[model samples]
Target: MMLHPELLRAARTARRPLGLATVLLAAITLTHLAQAVLLAVVLSRIAHGDTAALAPLLLAVLAVVLIRAALGRAQRLTAVTAGATVRIRLRDTLLARLGGLGPTAITGARAGAVRATLVDGVEGVDAYVSRYLPQALITAAVPPLLLVAVALIEPYAALALGLALVLALFGPRWWDRLLARRGKEHWDSYEALAADYLEALQGMATLRAAGAVGRVRERLEKRSAALHRATVAKLRVSLVDTGLTDLAVQGGTAAAVLVACSSAATGRTAATGTYLLLMLASECFRPIRDLSREWHAGYLGVSAADGIAALRTAEPAVADRGTVDARWDTAPEIRFLNVHFTHPGADRPALDGVTFTAPAGRTTAIVGPSGAGKSTLLSLLLRQRDPYRGRVTVAGTATAAYSLASLRRGIAVVSQETYLFHATIAENLRIARPAATDGQLRAAARSA
Candidate 1:
């Protein structure tokens, strides 16, 4: 599956530290390979009564063991560092994009879906960075080195090992397309379930008041069932892919062993050489198997990346002007000049060529029955939505011309349904003017 170019680049860039880790891991792999070859040499020497090679060969095995442990630790550290960097950058980019888009774009978005993306989706990338990427490199690198080593001892075994690797890597690629399609469906179902459950909980009070809680619960259950089904289907596909990869590895090992044994029988290769080639051939497929397993885990990350990329690509609201002077203390006049607006999917305009003015230092209350576009007018004045036909002006300048921060600085709104924070009364009012003196607060309270 093709990754988004930006995400792929980010993943690649994160691995700069892993360059050294890669070299270290390769050294470890080679050390293990050397140990295997040495074991074969030691066995051959023992048969010839050469007691001198035994002690040094035993010491070499101990050194290889230590190096292998050190290499594992180094690779893990580097992989974690890389994964963390990628996650931070991905999250920052997602948040910046979401912020630029503002609340309107997210108005209809599900809380649970957003939570899943911000939490689970971002976290899921860890496996891809830590396990999948390094393993893929090791799988690609180690197998060839082992093939060369095996070729030196037993060329026939090497040729057989090469074919097995081809089967292991390309065989999964064929299934990857299918797995990716299923994975997308699985993630969609999971997100849908999350959204449904979140919506149910959010409206639980209303549902209970209307005696519809059972119905909502039933709906949630249905979504849960659907999610379960999708998950199981994806799991089944993964099992099939895993089974195929294992089959290839086992079959390849068997073929290599048989070829080596026949070469030894014909005196084309020594028995010790045959054993060495067989051992290295088996080791060669170890990284390949890890890579195949990583491929399965990567499906989740790939799916998440798709969701994140889509969110990042959404067009933001008109670009924000840089911060402007907060001159709203001057109480600038508000005017709407032949403004028009139509809500999406509405047959008629919500505000048709509407024009009004509120003079400075005057209290001009808007009174209209519900659905008379009063709130729409307020929203327009607040620059929550731009007009379709005309413009709103504050102090003779177009509202859009000023930064959003500047436009809202002048207004103090109190709705009939007051939203009180879970704080002291003074704290609630302090939101209006954070640094107001005690006397000023008392005067404002008296005015209220």
Candidate 2:
């Protein structure tokens, strides 16, 4: 699937730290490659009884080890910083999108799916940032360096290494289609199980009282079994990928060993060159292995990305037109002109051409039987949902002309099902009128 431009922008911005990490990683790789060549030279000198070469070779190896260790530390620090920044941006963006959706856009979404997306789905990205991203850099950088080193020692060995890399990268693309399908099924089953579990927990008392706990438990068990099957299917894909990578690594190493041995035995290449070829061949596979392991973890992240993208695509309840006049005090009065609305698939209209007017400083009470569209009227006034046909006006301007936030500021709503925050009563009431004095609060409560 094509990634959204906003998501791509966020991903790119979050990956800034990877640039520095890449440099350090490359330095480490080059130093290690140099150390391998030096070790091969030392071995050849030992065979010829040249002990003088051993001292410098030992020192070079020590220096390479130390540098590689330091580089590893720096890479870790950079990876963590990048992961944290990316995670924060992703979470903030998800929350902002959710906030913009309001109640209407989220009406059809499952709470369990949303919870999974916000909690587990977002957290899954850490693996991508910390493991997959850095490994991708190393795979891109280290492989070519190793191949070059191999080419200098044994050109045939270098050719084998290059083929191994192709098998490691593009070979996996062949299985991606299968993995993606299984991954989607796995995520779906997980979501279904989570939804069922939450529903059972919320209505535990009702289920028990009705003697239907057994049925609920049975259904949950079935969902669990389905999830297990999906998980196994996903694992099968991973095992196939692992097998392919291992085959490439082992086959390439054996080919390099044969080429090096043949060249050295025929006196066409020095012992040092043969040793360097073998070592570099092995080094070439490390990055490939790392990449494969990361791809195994990436399956879930790819699936989670689908969920996040879907959430981000949901349209906001109120559009930001950018020209909304916030000066409501001097604007024309709010008016509803024969507004009509019906929810999708509903048999009848909730508001059938309802007309109403509430001028500034005047209180209007809309009393009706339950299901007589009182709440629907309130929704229209709040601009939670636009009319199917007709227009709402605020201060002689269409409701669409006002900014969502600006239009909302001119009205306050109190419903029967009062939603209290997890705080003291004072705090909950303060949400409506933040600057209200304690005396004013008490008077308002008394009036209520």
lDDT per residue, candidate 1, 1-448, as tens digits? 2344645655875768656656666777777787888887887788668878699888988888888898888877887787788888878888888866766556666778876776677777766765676667777777887788888888778888888888877776777777778888888887888888887887888899999998888888898888899889888988887787888899999999899879978989876787787778779888877677776666667767777777778775455563555476577888999999987668988899998899988988878888889988887776777889898988888878878766666777778779889998888888877997888888988987
Which candidate leads the pack in TM-score?
2
- lDDT tens digits, residue span 1-448, model 2: 1122433444675657867766776677777677777887888788888897688779888988988898889987887787677778888888899978888778877788788877777666755756576677778777887788778877887898789778876776687789878888999898888888888997899999999999999999999999999999988987887888798889988888888899999987887777777777888888777777776664456668788888878888667773675575543466789999997679999988888887866666779899999888778767788899888887678877777777777666667767788999998888877998999999989988
Off by over 4 Å in 2: 1-8, 53-56, 203-212, 325-334, 359-363, 394-397, 421-448
TM-score, prediction 1: 0.87
lDDT of each: 0.78, 0.78
The clash number for model 1 is 0
Q: State residue 268's C-alpha deviation in candidate 2, in Å.
A: 1.4
